[model samples]
Target: MSDPIETAIFEKLAKADPKSVGGKSIEPSDVAKELQPEQWQRMLPKVKAVALGLMRQGKLTITKKGKAVDPNSFKGVIRLRLPTEAETAAALAALPPVVEDDDDFA
Candidate 1:
């Protein structure tokens, strides 16, 4: 089964803009705080993990000091955002269409 907390993290990322008012990338803490005000600190680790997962899946990007970083290896502050439209289109093109198999019960 999928983790609901992880799902919530992804949903928050999906709704976040890639750039902020001053053109800064959105930090993982931003989402965490938005999801759980005073409890954001406890939520940080999980949020970062989910962001890394999304980065690996090409659904999001992670950066540090304005440069992209390896999500699995990065150990410091990082930012997360939905992929650009072009990246999103390319990722969609790379995926095979889902086809439900009706033979599961047979």
Candidate 2:
């Protein structure tokens, strides 16, 4: 089963209209906004788990450049490439369609 926090992030990313690659790394605000206080509390561990999983899979990498990249600093920002149209279409196609009365889930 998909972790709910990761699912929340995915859903946020899926709906986002990313306008720029620079500035702040896509703030977690959008996803955070979707969750209630209780939901966010429950989601923290799952978010960490998903991040660790991505790190283990080598999808997320930490670059080192002593001093230039301090772990404590938040300035070392990198942009994430949003999927291409074809990729987005393929992703959307991979999902099962929403049933007529399934708006709540979809």
Candidate 3:
């Protein structure tokens, strides 16, 4: 099944997209706090992991200083936003194949 957490993160960012009548961007913590109010810190990493996965897929964008960045090699603060149609092509990055496993730490 598709991960609900990933779905929520994607949908939330979509709502903040200009094409969807939104002009603001969201932080990864916004999702963590919303979904795990009592223990958001634990959820933050998971949120980022899924967000990075989405970014790598070219289905999302992770911005730093209002500029698109390579998800595989970005540091410090980041904001989540949707990429423009023109950016979709350039946003796609070559990444190592994902090795599936049942381990939670994978």
**Per-residue alpha-carbon lDDT of model 1 for 1-106, expressed as tens digits?**
9765566655665565434222335777877887789999998888888777666666766778876676547888787655666655655665668998878775
Clashes (backbone N, CA, C under 3 Å), per candidate, total 0, 0, 0
* lDDT computed for candidate 1: 0.68
TM values, all candidates: 0.60, 0.36, 0.76
Sort all candidates by lDDT, best to worst: 3, 1, 2
> In model 3, where is the ten-residue run with the lowest total lDDT?
16-25
Candidate 1 lDDT at 103 equals 82
Order of quality (TM-score): 3, 1, 2
Most accurate candidate by TM-score: 3
lDDT of all predictions? 0.68, 0.41, 0.77
The total number of steric clashes, by the backbone 3 Å criterion, in model 2 comes to 0
